[model samples]
Target: MMGGPSENPELWAFLESLHCGEFLSGTVTAIERFGVFVALDDGPDHPVFPGVGFISFAELSWQRFEAASDVVQVGQRVSCEFLQFDTWNLEARLSLRATQPDPFQVFADGAAVGQKLHGRVTKLAPFGAFVQVVDGIEGLVHLRELAWTPVETPSDAVQVGDEVTVVVTEIDRERRRLALSRRKGSSEHR
Candidate 1:
């Protein structure tokens, strides 16, 4: 038998009263490729579902990850910031990552220009190569900064999955961007 709002007036009433930006506690009920569903405690039953709250993949964590399971598991308890009422689905839109400290902020706080760090190249583009200095933290090595020699493309100096030692060229905390260089010597290069 399926359960819904009509069958649980008390739960539905609580859900109906929830406003945006509220904080709520819930247990992860399901993890789909698109999002995670949560059975909110002290909340009303969803009009047509088991879970009263849902978190999109982008809201799962501040860090980039491969899957939803990497941030949360079924039955794991989580505290989330209620974003809005999903009127179409009769579910609460929540953000689990909002409750956690941003890893980028942490990395920015300790990082500085001209500091050399070891990283792994994650992607290659015509403009630059993306290297991960830490899990979820990546810096771009522009084609001009790839090496002392002139380069036509990022691949000329670096390839994806290559381990690279890069010097921080710029850190834009507001934009959450770290510019890195692999060149032998430049103003910001080590």
Candidate 2:
């Protein structure tokens, strides 16, 4: 929920002028473990933070990264899409990735079910192993699909960083989900 605007009428007016999904440009003023702050070129100065624009860690990039600094640095110019007004902080919640192309969308455009893809096992879970089919795209090979024979645990068949071949079994663009099957790739696979 949006809190009341600034005490100053001009600040409130500046905040009022903003709309969600609108593109905005700013110079990054600060980079924290939590997020990046940007000083809006056309907006009123923030009363507290270095900038009035805030981009959360999840919105920093489409690609997987260990830290925010890995995606951006202080003093870098950025173009972001306004997500919402953080009334509590009196700042604009922004998305940096919105200004860039979505790797998933690009991948899904040509991706098709039954297509065989080579990927690396990134992580193992009770139900399946996640395989990176492409940059920023990971598909799950369910436990049952691990092999033609019974698989008790994902680690038993695959380990992280292990390169494996898998067949695309399903794709849900709305959910950003991709399902892969090791068994379908080849009957010889373990």
Stretches of model 1 off by over 4 angstroms after superposition = 1-16, 19-21, 184-190
For model 1, how does the per-residue alpha-carbon lDDT over 104-167 read when each residue is reduced to its tens digit?
8899889988898999999998899999999889999998989887899888887899998989
Candidate models: Cα lDDT each: 0.85, 0.89
RMSD of 1: 4.0
Which pairs of residues collide in candidate 2? Answer: none
Runs with alpha carbons beyond 4 Å of true place in candidate 2? 1-3
Best by lDDT: 2
Q: What TM-score number comes out for model 2?
A: 0.93
Residue-level lDDT for 7 in candidate 2: 66
The top-ranked prediction according to TM-score is 2
Candidate 2 lDDT over 142-189, as tens digits, reads 999997889799988989999999999999888888999999898574
- In model 1, what is the error at residue 154, expressed in angstroms? 1.8
